[model samples]
Target: MDALFILTMLVVICALAFDFINGFHDTANAIATSVSTKALKPRHAIILAGVMNFAGAMTFTGVAKTITTDIIDPTKLEAGSLFILAALLAAIAWNLITWYYGIPSSSSHAIIGAIAGAGITAAGFGALKAEGFIKILKALIISPLLAFVIGFILYSIFKVVFKNFNLTKTNRNFRFIQIATAALQSFTHGTNDAQKAMGIITMALIAANYQQSTDIQLWVQVSCALAMGLGTSVGGWRIIKTVGGKIMKIRPVNGVAADLTGAAVIFGASYIHLPVSTTHVISSSILGVGSAHRLKGVKWGTAQRMVITWFITLPISGTLAAIIYYILNLFF
Candidate 1:
């Protein structure tokens, strides 16, 4: 095979690797509450989540289009294999690093940041579409807050509605309800997160002259979804422990509320083709539920640390990608 063909294969593999990392890293988002409440076993919850995530990927194509056409300037995407490989390598590296530490970092942001960094390094700032970046920035800023508000309102309503009911009955009902909420969360996860990998793979194919537009082929979509589902099945137990047991002690009621709120926000973002962080949405939802009871219910220090990490994710990934791209350019 020629050098170009080898590089194209490398880029595709790296894109799938990033998808796998995303699955494991974000598994905590869908399963944490159910696991913490003992509504499902850790292993069972992941299996359910993985299956739903795969199903969700088959349901939409809008978000994939947005990433391909809007995020970066397609015209500036030089027909080259080395550049695609460097960008995918940067994204995969950052994802693995964050996953090892059990950080629920934004995989979508990491990939987008990688593309932007590599694009800039290759052809200067003109290669980026500032408007697309702004849309992503807006989603990143607003989606979590929207989820928090929804969670607070929904949980408050749930509390009031069940006030006169027997506590035992209410708890039992919530446990059942959590199953549906978890499924919804998983569905939204598939719709949003899996498409991100599809977008990257499409972009890579376009960069390598294997395609003209950023549209994802059916095979690309299926492969991306399957990779993520398999990764989720393996379970990111450390992150699941942190999200489910460490952040707050979740009751069935809280679990349902958080999942429902997260699903709403994520689904809404996916509808608009904005790649928001499922991790951020669910974390904020959990915070909302905890704070709604009383401010003291939240572990402020742990939350503070997560918030700091959230603030730093894009810039750190962007810098990492830039350096990787610079170094790879020399060798290639």
Candidate 2:
């Protein structure tokens, strides 16, 4: 054995671990509304989400390529393997912390910030590809806002069109519709979130001189999909509680609206090969629906707390990763 081989193995294990954790951490968001509205039972929803996530993960590689090259070139940094490992560790740690506390934080922010932190630590601030990094940052910031707007408008239209319909019958029909929307949201989540791990793995390969291009290999894609699917089987109950109920008292109609909005925004991002936070997008869509339903019905306290977490995640994770990289440098 070679040292590089061991290091690359560590990167793969950690990246997969991050993806697995992401499945449990964020998959809850995708199905929260459906579960809350009783559109799907919890057990059935998890099974459906797991299968859909795996299928979605297998379907796309564009976002994975962006991750491989966008943040900072792994080959250009000194001790690049350690840098990626630190980023993964920091991201995993932040995700677990938020998940335990039932706060829906952005795994996208955590990983992106960690990569920047580790890269700066390894090669100073000069190593960043300014244009590409800013492009990703813009996507993360804008997508959730778009979700919010779309959710609000779509639900308002729903209100006008369905005003005269029978409430009980309409709710029943929407409940069935939620089943489809929930699966779509979960599939879109898989398309985006699973690719982050694939990107990390590809970066490791490039760093170790195992490959030259940002092309995602077939094994990388499948392994990431499996990891995410297996992790989705272990549902995040705390998140389900927070997202499904705390933001607003969701009816089946509202759940369907939010699910559609989230799915559309996330899938659109994937189509353009940009990474956005599924957590942020889903939650924002719910908030939008809540606002449209009844401004007074929305829980501002929970919304405030989540927003605070979103704003601080990047700086905190970055600082954490930088410290981890420094400590790892000593032992390696």
TM-score of each predicted structure versus truth: 0.96, 0.99
Write the residue-wise lDDT of candidate 1 on 224-262 in tens digits. Answer: 899989988988877787778667778999899899999
Residue-level lDDT tens digits of model 2 in 125-198:
88788898999999999999999999999999999999999999999999999999999999999999999999
- Separately for all candidates shown, the number of backbone clashes (residues 3 or more apart, or on different chains) is 0, 0
Candidate 1 wrong stretches, greater than 4 Å = none
Model 1 residue 42 lDDT score: 78
State the TM-score for model 2. Answer: 0.99
Model 1 residue 270 distance off true place after TM-score fit, in angstroms: 1.0
For TM-score, the strongest prediction is 2
Instruction: Please list all clashing residue pairs in model 1, or write none if there are none.
Output: none
